[model samples]
Each structure stands twice: as C-alpha cells, then as structure tokens.
Target: MKPRLGVPSDLEAVTSAVIRTMPLDPQWDYRFPYRHQYPADHYKFTRMLFEYFLDPSFDDWLVMVAEDSLAPGDSISVVSFGVFDISYVNKRRHGPGYKPQDPVTEVENRGGKTRRDANHKHFNEFWKGQIRAYKKYFAPLGPEQMHLQILGTLPEFQRRGHASSICRWAMDHVLRKSLKDMSVMASPMGYNLYTVLGFERVGTFYIQVPGEDERLVLQAMMYKPKIWETKTTEDGDGACVML
Candidate 1:
C-alpha cells in the first residue's frame, strides 16, 4: 500500500527524522542559520517550525511522509511546503500583518504602515530594488508564482524513488486546485529532481557557510504546468487528482 499522506501526526518523530538527515542534506544545514535567525539544535529547529509553521495550518501547508513499510517508525522522506492563499502576498520590509486600526499602524505613522504591508508592498519594492542592484545576475519571474519550502530524503533511502514521489505528490496536490505557478530554491542534489518534474531555472542565490568563507550556490526553479496537465499518477501510472 502507499504510505500515508498527512502532516506527521507525531511532532517529535517528524522533527527527529528530518534533523537526523540534515548533514546529508546540506541545504538544510546551510539554510538553518538563516531560517530561524539563531543557531538551533537540528531537531529542536525542525520541531519548532513544524509545530508553528506547518502543523496547525493544514489548509495552507502540506507535509507529506513516506514510511518504512515494515518498521514504519518515522518517515523516510519528508517534504514540507505551502501555497499562500490569494489574499496573501510577499513583502521584503514588513513583519506579520497588523490589525487594520492598531495604535501603531495609522497612516500618520510611516513605520506602522511599512510593517503592515511587509509582505505586499515591502516584497514588491524589495524585488524591484534587487533587480536594480543585481541586473547583471537577476532575471524576471514568469507568469506563475508558487514556492517550495523544503524537500529532503535520508541518504540511505535515496534512489528508491522517494524524492520523486515527494515532488510529484506535492505538485499534484497544488495543481488539482489550479494553484498558480510553483517555485523552489533548489540544492545541487535537488536540481535534477525538479527538472524531471518540469520546473525550469529562473535565477540563483549564494550564501556564505556559517563558519567558513566559502559560499554555496543554489538555483531558483519554477514551474507553470499546462492547465490540461491537472492529473496525478503514481510512478507515472494510474491517473488521480490530489486536492
């Protein structure tokens, strides 16, 4: 039978599995410092984000798992990503949304206005600035827009089709609802998998290793599926649609 498809109901198990595999998944190790703003024990970081960013928000996020079948202990593969509802937008300078009339956000208060529109105004403006500052390297985004938060597989389980399963599963789920385009910052190991799934390169990002001077490079990949390609198949067979 196919492995289950829900956020891992057990918080600890889910975090443990993902963290234990982090070294083998360097993007996780490299992105960790930036993701939470401070150093965190691998498992603790995964647990905190899973509980806060993913678990309770099932409607907007999907966390899928593949199990051992026999041992069936923790997941062997974990992919956690989400789609922002139409109402949501990205901002570069804003924090989370504030109440419309909060004491802080009155139009008279410029700082409050900036914070209130972080995801929308701040993000749009930020991208514009990035374009101006990095014109030689930056390229424009295409019509579709979606983001891939994370995808990882234990090294022991690599090449068993687990990675492919996770990508196809998540993409199928979004496409069935006719989600806008999807995107991800792909690690070197992940680039091939995304390409196989029809995502194309759009840009790149570089990050310095936490304690080293060397920088690691990542590709920004995006996909805009043909509207008619709304069907999902397991291992490329048996068409089904995921919600």
Candidate 2:
C-alpha cells in the first residue's frame, strides 16, 4: 500500500494507529509510564498530540499515513504513520493551535490532582528534559534541515515497507525543497532501519524516571540527501545495518 499525505480528517485514525504501534518500541513504553495504570489518559494525551500535528493552521509540519484497502468499499485501515517538522531554523516553534498553557490550566482547574494530572506533569518534565538534552548535544545541519518527530508501523504491518514508504516521501520532499538533511530520535528497534536509510548516529541518550526500573535509550540520527544513490536503486531498497 502507498502512503498519502494526511489531512485533519485523518486525525483519529492516525492517532489510534500511533498508539497501537508505539509500544513496539521500548523507549516509548518507558516514556509513557502510566499507560498500564491509566489507559484512558494515555489515549487522551496521544490524541491531543496527533491533533496538534494535524491542525491545518500548522503549516510547518507534514503528516503522512499508509493505508490498506480492506474491501470494495471506501473503508481503509491505517497501517503506519509519520510526522515531519519542516523548519530547522524555527526550532523552538510549537504547533500553531497547540497551547501548552491551556492543557496545564485545564488539568489544574479540575480542583484536585488526579492520576491523569500527575501523569501529565511527569510526562511534560520528561519531555522537556529530552528536548534540552537534544539541543545541547545536537545542532541542526542548517536552516534547510527537517526533523522526523515520529514514525511507526503497526505490528501487524511490520516488514511490509509502510514506514519506509513514508520516510522516502519525506526525503523526496526534502530534495525538492533543496533541504540539506533530516534528523530523528530513533529507538533501538528503529536504529537499524534508519541506518539503512543513510542516517548516521551522532549521539545517544537515556531517559530514566525517578522511581522506575526501566530506562529508555534513544539514538540521535541525521540523514543527508543522497539523490544520486537513491536514483540508482529501486524505492525502499536500502539495506539495514544492524548495530
């Protein structure tokens, strides 16, 4: 199945697919520490995240979804999804319609703090720390570089080339726009895949929660546009280099 540019209407389906696929990575599982105890809150946070990505007002980001036709009807299944942030120069910019204050206030306005509220607070701190570390250790290639924020394929759809298709789509867009490179924070499971696509590991980081036993490890990877190499091979023919 081919991947297509996603629209606001695809928000719910894409969010569900993301939540389903993300746990396949140990890092995501460790970061979303409350998933088992508070499934509803986990879903809510995931939905809000995708809503921010899909908001039409946010032109600096692009979302692509891979789908499978289930029948003769128009129904389809989302097999994989990817979100790319197009502006490396505006590195600190947030999605247009996403107001971090609103969510924080909303949670506080509920009077007493619930488990969900605590989870939100913990996750925010964790996310902020990761961003700070990223900024400290990794600098953008240039104004023309792009960031791959998230990419995942449903477990059932793994090895089907869904994720690769979306990745190639982003690379093609980068080439057309004359962008210099692309970067991503890759989980151990995805490290090999990104390496095969020509992304090199620049650094690694580990995220550990105060009371948690599991620590999440991630690799920072950067990919430069290699149009000449891509042109000589069939799409999605890149080799995976296991580390």
Candidate 2 per-residue lDDT over residues 86-168, each given as its tens digit: 65434436443333222333433443144452344445545665676557545534355777888998886788798898998
Please provide TM-scores, in order, for all candidate models, with all chains considered together: 0.58, 0.75
Each prediction's number of clashing residue pairs: 7, 0
Deviating ranges (above 4 Å) for candidate 2: 69-75, 88-122, 209-214, 227-243
lDDT value for candidate 1?
0.50
What candidate 1 gets wrong by more than 4 Å, as runs, is 1-3, 31-40, 57-59, 70-145, 209-212, 229-243
Clashes of 2: 0
| TM-score for candidate 2 | 0.75
Please report the TM-score between candidate 1 and the true structure: 0.58
The model with the greatest lDDT is 2
lDDT of 1 by residue, 32-88 (tens): 434334334334434655654334433334455665532467544343322222111
How far residue 124's Cα lies from its native spot in candidate 2, in Å, is 3.3
Worst 10 residues of 1 by lDDT: 98-107
